[model samples]
Target: MSKGKDSPAKDGKRKSKFSDAADSPKKSKKASTSANAAASSSTSKAGSGQATLSVKGSGSSFKQLSKSGAAFASFADYNPAPSTKFSIYRADGLPDETGASTNDTDERLLLAGETDTMAYVGNNFEFGSSSEARGYTGHYMVGVYDPSSSSVTLRAVPTFQVARSIKANSSLSSISSKRTFADYGEMTAARRALGDAFGNRKQKANARNQDRMKVDTANMEVILDDFTGGIQDNLASLPSLDEVLASSTSSRPMPPANLDAKHPAEAYRISDLIPSEIFKSLPIQKLIDNVSDPEALKELLPYSKDFPAWIWSRLVDNLQRSSHLSGGSGGKKHTTFDEDEDEAASVTNAEDVMMMPALGATEDKEDAKTKVRIAYYMSLLWYIQSRPKSVSQRGKLITALKLDGEDANKRIVKAILGTFTETPANSDRAVMSAFHQTKVLAYMCALALHLDNFSVDHDKLARNCNIPPATLRELFRTLGCTASVVGGEKRMVLKTPFTLPQPRKGKAGGRK
Candidate 1:
């Protein structure tokens, strides 16, 4: 007889209350004991267009009920925060069901009011297979463990097909947002595999994060140990960081020298970040000719700080003005205007780039590296903006840029974004080579979002990418733009500035 909270919403009529855990004084203490309960999982029969998710507490202290709204947040939590505290994203590449998610900025109509504790498993649920559907599900696949009891169980029926799931694509997500991890062991493994990233710097400080629970989706059930008494013993038993770092030191390559140093090229013109080849293209040349103030775009990118307003304005102007050029392959004959443009950006053949001497100087190597870093970033920006969605995913586009960052580029690029395999790699690395290009894209995207300014237009991003944005949002999060709205209308805010760790004070200095 209940309208919605206890009963399912039938038509477009009624929706349930979006509930939060309001624990009583006695239950609050009891909730802490259950926080680390060893959790297991089992999938029920999932037929076409129908599913049921049930969470039952095995603890005698807890009651058996059909819908215990208060019991939802009694367990664990995630950083990227799943749609429902009890919800399971299970897989990595699921579609963004903002309707069933806890999105404050969501503009979708859902079966029921969604929150951290509840979601809908009714008819009319839809997720598709497009480039839009493949990347960043905007959902972090994680399972919470109940620490108060011996174990808890999470069950779900499947609705969507498995999209592209790069289980090892750990670098492309938040510290807690991994591919598919159910329990504490898997969660810990996922964290270490996250390797290095700016996103990992600030972890969500919650005692729940420290709580241990078993979450294994592959198997129907996970039998976790009795971790209620003390998980600290388990944590202490784990390998030390110093031991891990020392072991990885031999495998880890040396870092680059001076990344922020001024290059001889800066004396010529700071905007020379663009590569020599194809820089003479009329469209590219327009950036300089049409600019009112050079200083607007003069900051020279790859810096996570807020960029000049003019920089993004010029970039948008160029992209919007050149929509026809989005898919154009370079063979078009140039007009007379191209000849009179910046001489430094003269169009060069592949041979020229190859023969471009590895500029000499023990005194000038840092500058050379800096110049390379800048040029690669510029080249990547131009490539992504001017290219089509198909090419963007493929490794060939990045290969064509051919601008190497020497030693530091890889490390810097990795720090910014671990990997972006727009396309599949054969035997070598994954679509990861695209990390350099993605790092450049992330920098530009975050920079456009001024600190003083809260949001940046999403449709403009779609226009710039030459395709409606989807999983690339993960790249944005990897750098600094933590949260984004689900739909394309609202602006994506840049709350945190993307920053790299300052070099330790102890390191030896280079020749001044």
Candidate 2:
């Protein structure tokens, strides 16, 4: 009996659970229908022309409308009236207090169901010519008026002010086209006076010629003064040529006893090899001659370290000055050096002199000139690479070179390569020796930094440097540098650490 009761109870529980699950979906469907109905009702109300009247933009309820144009009004519920009219009245102090009106004499008829109409209400509404008496300025009352019922329905009562005249006379008061007989007569008289002033052509021409002659005379005087002033002064101050040569050729001036004591070998060696007159004539001699200040002479130690240093510094300086005076001709105009046989022979001899023997020992003038040309180019390249302050001069040089044509850059690259490769025998050894003596390896590295973006191509750099690709790789490796293959190209990059000086800030009370 207990088991039979338990079975009926289980059946009842199953039926109850099934009924609850079915009822949940029905309830959700009814709720969704009610929500949709509410949304539809709100949409219908919005579509029924129940929009609040306001300006298109926010911030202010009262709009500043132009007196000569129509203003729009949004309606809450649009209803057409055949006799609807828009009236504008001057309301000065209070809303209830009505003063003068534009519509008192004439009303602007508005079309039924129209949102906008011409609000200007005077027959003589000439914009700029309308006066304050015509109710064009100050606070205004604007509303929809029905003529049949004699009732006004207030809309937006925007303040009206006279619009700035877009016509010519309003903005440009000084200009006017109105002309009288007197004005025309005055213009004609002025023209005639000008014509009379310039009537005599021969006299005008003579006067112009006289002025030009006077200008030329003045210019000539200026030129004469510029040309003669410095020459005359210098001539008067100059010593006799014989006396000058004697002084220059005199025995080499001795450094102070203290300097000789400190550097006996250097002093004796320098004195024996260099004549006093010749040594004194050096450009750097002036700096060295200040024996009273031995401290300043320390700057010459770097150049005096080795014989080559001393010779090369002076040689490079002379070469640079000559190049500057010649405008960097670089032996480009010498026809003798242009022949392929002569060039090949010269290159071969240069290689022997550079690689096998010491530099400055060659007695051949042609070889010397060629070396000088190469040295000049190297000096210039070094200057441009190492000196940040020379950027302007570099730009000028580049522009001048580019005047040669589109291949000017290529020509320059060839010239740079020749410096490295012109020595046919042991090109790498010769290039290394020249660069070491001149301390131009840093300049070359700086140049590589400048010519390429970040990575310099091995073949292109070798061509520009005028060395074998393998030689260049070895050179970079010797300098403790490395190369990597990127995008199927072998590239080398040298990075050196440097610090830029920070700009000094102005004092608080200082002038800018």
Candidate 3:
């Protein structure tokens, strides 16, 4: 009735305007077309025969498809159906609607335009046992249920097998093996006893006992007060100071024959500054012999500075003369052959000379003698180096070698290095030998200068020098170097003079 009241044309125009205001025809058409295209694309993908289903992570042998996405299967192959259910099953052949599902649930529903993931727990089965026993082996099948078709389609089929967890042989061996637990208790008891015997508590107890014993031993019966009291009592009972002085004078030994009976100072000479005991202990002949003997020379080298100037001079002179004698006199050679003849003769003579046993033997003997002399010279050099510069005789020898001056140590080092390159002769051989023997000594001196004052392990130093420990000990004694056992090892204590200032005595008789 209302439509009739208004004009049909006007009503139609109003409806058209309202519709236009609500939405444009062109926009509506485009939106509808786009949505339809998406639905069609999804349907096309689902219907494509190229879609396949696959399973992954089966075993090491199936590693080719184990990686993620490598064995991924799309649900596109399954035709769209209402209330479609997906199920997984294990089957030997092609799975069908009759096939039993491996999954616990009957089916999984996947909604339209939506995705759902289903996780299924695998059935527990023996892995290695015989089929008759418990294990099973076969392929896994994924089935797709179609309610419209009332049938199941085998979407994916992956092979699988069951294996026994425990081996038959291992099980049987375990059953047959025997073990004893009776010793366990005894072992535990013994361990406890041992722990009690040597544990921290016992160690602490022993330490405490040792401390108590030390304290008991250290506790002296005579204190300072008691000692002073005893001394006073003894003084009261003893003779006076005058009587003691008279007794000491009467008991003294007679003066020496060389000393004046009335005045001993008049007979005293500067030479007497060195005690006669030193000469007595080390005789002149013995000193000369030691210098010549290699073994004895090693012993005397450390005490070289202690020997008198005359003794040092005699030693050097003897070594020089001996070296000269050992090495025959030096003279110019007069060759009978000219250059060409000499060359030819030398070539022919080399083989003949080698063939002559007597000549070879004589050469070897001379070489040995040369080595002995070289060793002797080395010992002499080592001795001279050990001597103090204040010793005029040692200084004279040093000057003669042209090795004197402020940098004496450096000059000596250079001379030592040169000896190795220079031809072996009287003086040169002596110098080289000395360098070889005293190389370690020189190194020690340099180290001492670096450290200023240091202590060295006696054994370690001997080993470093390639000298015997006994020889090193003798050397230490000869050099007036004191060796004392420190930290359970013998050490050479080198004290640098004037390193520390002497303490002054205060007016009150206290050290300042």
Candidate 4:
């Protein structure tokens, strides 16, 4: 999504270990050279003459007018080089009648010799972008360029409007206008601070009639209708089934052949994406029970929300070398809750001490503390989930003291879909270069979470993510939607529901 490069880190950002899916603000690159810098350079070259320069903005889309064959056909071909060498004075150049009352050519000032000292910088000197140049000075730089070009041309120099000194001509009078301010309908601070979500409840009578987006929002309405003779939806195009049946009495509708007798599909929940074996294998629960400070995690809940749900999955990876989770066989050992808790208590003092030697990795004592903190955070979430159910008449979730109050079994899921795992390139297990970064994967996962019924246009998402339409279509198909094009816009439509991969019941590493 960063155009094959990593986004630059933002300053003063609160980064955490639980942020494998969090998006970091990227520093935008700005052009270094500006008109002020150019002006200074030109002034130094002029040696007190103060070389005048003005940039005029021009629309490059004017080339479409060439279809009429009437614009700029008589003008000579202009050289499109970056920089050109020329003397200060030239006889054949456009006449410079600026700052003069006479229209005579002899009155124009011209300088000869020292052609090497005066190099006219062509339009492309500042990466061929006129907007950046214009931004440095609050003025447009106009000149002939290809479709999107804007530069100072030799012809425009004669008409350049240089800034002139302003002198006071009259004394000011202490007068005030009769009208003060107009009554514009603007929001008050209290009302504006409440935002659009305040008191926005919809009546049952105005319930949505459609389930999915049928077309791109910019191109057409969600429900396309026509009223040539009478108001009708797209279904009006099809002939009635009764009319077809009446046309031929002998023709009967064929019954569906359910010879195979396939069973119905099971409903999939958001929790099924990650394997349960991972939670069982990890000893985070043990850390929660044995750690002394449960309040630390309670305080960290707000910060932990900075990360997406998938970030919890990365704990397993970041703690690969932690003494708490590591075992003798390089695999986690199965133990009862009490046994793990006792073991956790024994290592409480060693949380700050590195029990294992570092094998060229940063994971050590700090990771041990991290593992405990993660458990504490998980315990806090469990505590929040275990609260008594409350029907709040006012306020919202994520508000102060607000609670979901449901059965507490929200096991976090590792990102198996739209996630990347790197391996040796030639080992035949390497994941191809795709949406591999943390922010991009999280962005895509958020999109997945927003989809309810299907049939979605991801043009805006694809453009923002820097993904090609075809590539996004394939990704959508991989994410459970059938890729399609409705009204020239790519859409993802769900027919048969997609199910995440899970092991059979009663099997090892299966969800029990």
The best candidate in terms of TM-score: 1
Question: What TM-score does each of the candidates earn?
Answer: 0.21, 0.15, 0.20, 0.17
State the lDDT of candidate 3 residue by residue for 44-74, as single tens digits.
Answer: 3332122211112222212222222111223
Name the TM-score of candidate 1.
Answer: 0.21
Off by over 4 Å in 4: 1-272, 276-419, 423-450, 478-480, 483-490, 497-512
Alpha-carbon RMSD, each predicted model: 37.4, 29.1, 30.7, 37.6
**lDDT per model vs. reference:** 0.33, 0.35, 0.35, 0.31
Could you tell me the TM-score of candidate 4?
0.17
Comparison by lDDT, 1 against 4, better one: 1
Model 3, residue 202: distance off in Å is 60
lDDT of 1 at 120: 33
Ranking by lDDT: 2, 3, 1, 4
Residue pairs clashing, model 2:
252-276
Best by lDDT: 2
Decoy 2 TM-score against native: 0.15
Alpha carbon lDDT of residue 504, candidate 2?
Answer: 68
Instruction: Count clashing residue pairs in model 2.
Output: 1
Cα shift from native, residue 420, model 4 (Å): 3.3
Q: Which has the better lDDT: candidate 2, or candidate 3? A: 2
* 369-468 per-residue lDDT for model 4 (tens digits): 4433333233333222222121021122223222233222222211221122344545534332332333233324322322212454655444433446
